[model samples]
Target: PPDVEQLGRATWTFLHTAAAYYPERPTPNQRANMLNLLHSLPTLYPCSHCASHLGDNLKEHPPDVSGKAALSHWLCQRHNDVNERLGKERFDCTKTDERWKDGPSD
Candidate 1:
C-alpha cells in the first residue's frame, strides 16, 4: 500500500496539472465537472486521515471555480494548508502558473 506521503504527492501532482490545463474561461459544464471532482476528493481519496482533513478544510474554505486563476489559487491555498500541517514551507501562490504550467525563465 502507498504511504501517505506518496499518495499526497501523486494527488497533488494530478490536481495541480489538471488545474494548470483547465480552461481559462470554462463553460458551465466544465465548471460543474471541476466542482464535482473537487467535492468528490474528500470522500473518494484513499487516505482516510488526509481525506478527513481535506473535508474539514473544504467546509471552512469552499472551492472557487469561477475561473482558471481562481481555481489555481484556491488549490495553492489548499496545498499550503497541508504543507503547514506537515511543517513544510508554503509555496508561492503567485508563481502557481509558472510552476504548474510554464517553466521558469532561465
Candidate 2:
C-alpha cells in the first residue's frame, strides 16, 4: 500500500456540507470553528485542485467569518477549490479521513 503520510489534509467546504442536510443555521461554535480552520492556515501541502500549494491572491480573502466572530473558515488549497467549484463543478475523494488515526505530534 502507499505510504499514507504522503497524503494531505482534509479540505472540506462546510458550507456545502452543511447546506446539504442542514438548511437551518449552524451552532455558533460550529460556524466559528469552520471559519477559523479556513482562515488562519498559512500553507497547504496538497492543493485542492491538484498537487500544488495554495496561491497568494487566493489566500488574501478573509473567510466570511465576520461580525465579531471568534473563528474563520480557513481552507488549504484543496478545500478552497472545492468550495469555489461548487454549483459550477465538484471533486470527490475515494479515501477516508485517515490523518486522525495517527497520534498527535510534538
Candidate 3:
C-alpha cells in the first residue's frame, strides 16, 4: 500500500497532466465531467485529513473549469497551497506546461 505522501503525489501528477491535456474549449459535457471529477476528490480521496482540507479549499475557491489553462492554473494554486502547508517548496506555476506536458529543456 502506498503511503499518504506517495498517494498525494501520484494524485497530483495525474490531475495536472489531465488538466494540461484538457481541451482549450471543452464542450459543456466535458466541462461538467471535469467539474464532477474535481468535486468528487474530496469525498473519494483516501486520507481523511487530506480530504477534509481539500473539501474546505474546494468550497472556498471551487474548480476553474472554464478551459484548459484556467483549470491548470487553478490546480497549480491548490497544489502550492498544500505544499506550503507541508513546508515543501512550491512549484512554479508559470512552467506548468513544461513540467507536466513538455519535457524540460536540457
| Best of the candidates, TM-score | 3
Every model: Cα RMSD to truth: 2.1, 10.5, 1.9
Candidate 1 structure quality by residue, lDDT tens digits, 4-99: 888888888889888988989999999999999999998999988889999999999999888889999999999999999989999999998898
lDDT of 3: 0.93
For 8-33, candidate 3 gives per-residue lDDT tens digits of 87898899999999999999999999
Clashing pairs in 3: none
Model 1 residue runs over 4 Å out of place are 104-106
Q: After TM-score superposition, what is the CA distance of residue 48 in candidate 2 from its true location, in Å? A: 12
Winner by lDDT: 3
Output the TM-score of candidate 1.
0.94
How accurate locally, in lDDT, is each candidate? 0.91, 0.37, 0.93
lDDT of 2 at 65: 39
In model 1, which range of ten residues has the least summed lDDT? 97-106
Better of 1 and 2 by TM-score: 1
TM-score against truth, every candidate: 0.94, 0.31, 0.94
Q: Provide the clash count, candidate 2.
A: 11
